[model samples]
Target: MNSEEEFFDAETGLESDDSCEVSFKDATQENGVWERRKKLPAEMISRNNFSVWNILKKCIGMELSKIAMPVVFNEPLSFLQRISEYMEHTHLIHKACSLSDSIDRMQVVAAFAVSAVASQWERTGKPFNPLLGETYELTREDEGYRLISEQVSHHPPISAFHAESLKKEFEFHGSIYPKLKFWGKSVEAEPKGTMTLELLKHKEAYTWTNPMCCVHNIILGKLWIEQYGTVEIVNHRTGDKCVLNFKPCGMFGKELHKVEGHIQDKSKKKRRVMYGKWTECMYSVDPKVYEAYKKSEKKSGGESKKLRQERSCEAEEADEMPEVQETVTVIPGSALLWRITSRPAHSAQMYNFTSFAITLNELEPGMERLLSPTDCRLRPDIRAMESGDIDLASSEKERLEEKQRAARRERSKDEEEWSTRWFQMGTNPHTGAEDWLYTGGYFDRNFTDCPNIY
Candidate 1:
């Protein structure tokens, strides 16, 4: 068994794929996002004592699931930021609204589904739990999209979020409750919920489930994350569906980032195949073209007309591609691939985040002016973390937690409970479960008429 600090500051250094003799300090600062830390936070270090290690070993071996870890290592951002990470790639879903054919829409939705996992790769830091009724909203002026998320329940830790692009006629809404399990060297977090997205123009609705996320090497090695399981997105009205299976990495680290799946009609046997390494890109090809591509792994001479046609369809539609990266445009053909875009820089390099991952916690420019005092974006502790003042961040975090405790005490004494602002508790007709539902409507409601309650 390894000591608590064995991987943190070992004199011999930790093993890594890279040849350079990188210390934990140097490795974490590799991305140049934030300066190297002198040591781990005092709380995290103190919690790593012998008693904590013994408890972790026994509890994890027993597979005592649904257990919560201590909050010492939590990031300064709120859980609302974590929920909004799904919307960072909303442009993909919005594009589905413009496609007339169900096949094209399925492809866009599959891309949307796959993009959600991009932010979780290599990310191990937990976000702070949002206070009851705390809210967050992000409005993209250029994209004409708005996202609103709120902490609707505190006891079971549920968050509800809604996003829409009125111009694109696309909307997404869902609630998430993460089920956590500790396993000695790793933690498994599976979101207990379903999400639905709708395209108003086509009157199409798509629903999908989330996969399990595993945080690896918490005690003996470098910390990172992996997500595995099949995520199926179904278009209820069109009967078109895409089943994406996220491949888990092996013990020796083989097959890292590989994913394969297909899109097919509900009744038809024919399918369009898609496969690729998710960390880089995902490519789609017709079944026949895919078989041919598989056979011609080394030969470049064999190209099909169907592949050329698919390529032309994707390339000709410049409107479907996001303008985040210039390298997004690829040669049209049977191998149509969507590469992950670049993300904003992080404070440390430990998390190998994709381009949009950094924006997950970002309160977009000028958003403070529109935010209410109670909004998570206005939290002092989170702001301190964002600015790299870890000490101040820790102090502010303690202060906020104390404040929350006091508020809860007062509320309990007064027999009062917090309620959500932008969302309402409703029963899900399909699942028969009570969940938070967004009340804002695209065509029926006006934003100007909505109150600024945050």
Candidate 2:
């Protein structure tokens, strides 16, 4: 098989053998009415004919967002819709909100943070960048939450989102400006933004930033992705903290998908040790057990190193990669913190989207009448792509981009500033950093002042 075909086979695999037993429910409430689509109109088009290296050859070491990528490289969803995926595991936030122990609350919050990125696994396709003034709203009465997101800036491409529970239990909001760079063999995304979650019941606020994610082997060999960095989540009210280390895939791939961390109390005393694979599940155990496990692991590593030295020549010549352990080896007393929700049976053919994600772009009959003029659901390009019209999608995407550019030039000539509708740039009360705070009034359904970006 060709490299691209081989990559697809490795990435998507076969249709699930248990498809017959899998639930295909797409039930989500809208306006107290239940209706949703379980699948996109068509399966994702194959990438076998495209050569990424040809497009990225001269763009190495540059910010990728500045380059114009083809629509084929993108899934049907916009970046605003992608941001909404963060809410898929909102139950973790509710769990954290209900806990009385500060340390216990911190553990659940940490799991929620990790779970936020779990949807990206094997999802190599990018989301379409939102036009300036574009917006997306997701309301799930069943989940007791509603989210509103907007493309606040276009030049640096900032996307700001706010989500709150109907019962006023918690508030989650953030403004992200990811810096994407192409490094010849890989593409790296540094999510440069602060994410804040507030538990209204406890009056506690937590803040943290996402880790750097890298897609490797872009030019050759099998493609893979890894997240690597230190993420520090702090509770402002309780002075508690959780530090997680997303390990990079080393030469032997032994550390692939591993996440390890600890939760500390106000006094800097370690309260619990957490470890797991971010792709599957997370577990928290007593600090003493973690330390004993580490000691035993270190001794085993010492023995492996000696054996490696004896066969150093053979190892250097070996082309095979080590098999990654799929499941986390839980200690006897470890408590389950969080586990990923399974994707739909058709996920492999449908952009690798989770069940929650499959509903993000579903535009039910008459739904557009309720959305703002600038909502992403009205974007013709995305709609065309979703309907499996590749040529129309490509043409519409180009036209929309040109329209955006023309509008920018017109505003520049008139010396006018673009005004955001739902969110405004302001100082975050908790972090004291400049952020896009939701100005409310979005749910009031006044579309008179909304932009005509679509």
Candidate 3:
């Protein structure tokens, strides 16, 4: 059978009444307990005057963290706050913990991993590089989780975060040191770190690293982002593993935003095949059905080759490549695992932020009194930027950076080492790699030893 006939068969199967039902509490609901702003105080300004190529031409092949950037390219949030967005899909973790079957639990865990990156769909603005000794804390009693993030390193720019359920059912923590490089028309970021999730009730621990992300058309056309690499998630206690491959966009753009992988048991037997687009949703199907579809697709390869050749010819005649369809075509008998939460209506005017990201920098009434002085909420530059004062934000950013430099010089002159208040350098027990671990005590609210970096 041809590929078109196979697709028709799949569509017919999708209409069957026996499709599986996916259930979970909505992650976007706040339950009237806490209120968050739906939009930023000011809309994003135009970037026509600024030229990224002019600033980045000389810095190609170097780490972008070392280069000083203007506030015009920033999104009024710190990198620490950006990291906290991982918790937006906290319900997935809760769902994983509730499942009894190991394979079912592994499926939910894989869904959680993909959902973590969905927030980056249209987020192109850079987050403010966190200052040394800077910190961010988020307490969401509504969601039953509280997160604390801290900047532990300055030279290499490492951000460490730890989140735990209020009921102590699970813990999620990781330390990321992103190495960003400019390659003429694109900037690629290698997220170097291991993320671990511990389900205390099940005594199961899962560890995985994020895939590499790249922003294309930096010097020419519309800026687009893609994540492409292999992410291997391992369950230390059960020996189950999920291997996911984020496919790069091909010449024909047929594989854009595609992710495919399989789950294997301890004996290396493939149990389930998963396929979907990261931007929209993820689904899992039986290995038998997945194999059958691949065979049919291979049999129709002749037509695909002809189409690719035609597209290549058209590309040489046009200034831009043809637009690819953005939706995922799921196979029949696949169970839905996850879907992205929709953004707010005003998201486009607010740096393309999601509903959760719009509230990351909000300072509620009397909230400042309860926070540490070194918190990112108190950073003058970010505050100014969020309020639409571009001039003040730019000047404040320069002043704070100079102050940090002066402090570093003083410490060097006095032969002193910078001390991190919330986290310490340690080794990850599961991965056996050097990492920054959370040292419990940020919630105690005692700020005596915290540095005054702001």
* Cα RMSD, each candidate: 14.8, 8.2, 9.0
Cα deviation at 228, candidate 1, in Å, is 0.3
Question: What are the runs in model 3 whose C-alpha is more than 4 Å off?
Answer: 1-34, 300-303, 309-322
Candidate 1, poorest ten consecutive residues by summed lDDT: 1-10
Per TM-score, the best of the predicted structures is: 3
* lDDT (10s digit) by residue, model 1, range 139-203: 54334466778777777788888887736588888898876767766778888788888888888
Alpha carbon lDDT of each predicted model: 0.62, 0.83, 0.82
For candidate 3, the lDDT comes to: 0.82
Question: lDDT: which is higher, 1 or 2?
Answer: 2
lDDT of 2 by residue, 291-336 (tens): 9987988888654666544433223223223456778888888999
Going through the candidates in order, what is the number of backbone clashes in each? Answer: 4, 0, 0
lDDT of 3 by residue, 315-370 (tens): 32222333556677778889988877777777888988877788788776566677
Relative to the unseen true structure, what is the Cα RMSD of model 2?
A: 8.2
As a whole number from 0 to 100, the lDDT of residue 182 in candidate 1 is 72
Q: For candidate 3, what is the TM-score?
A: 0.90
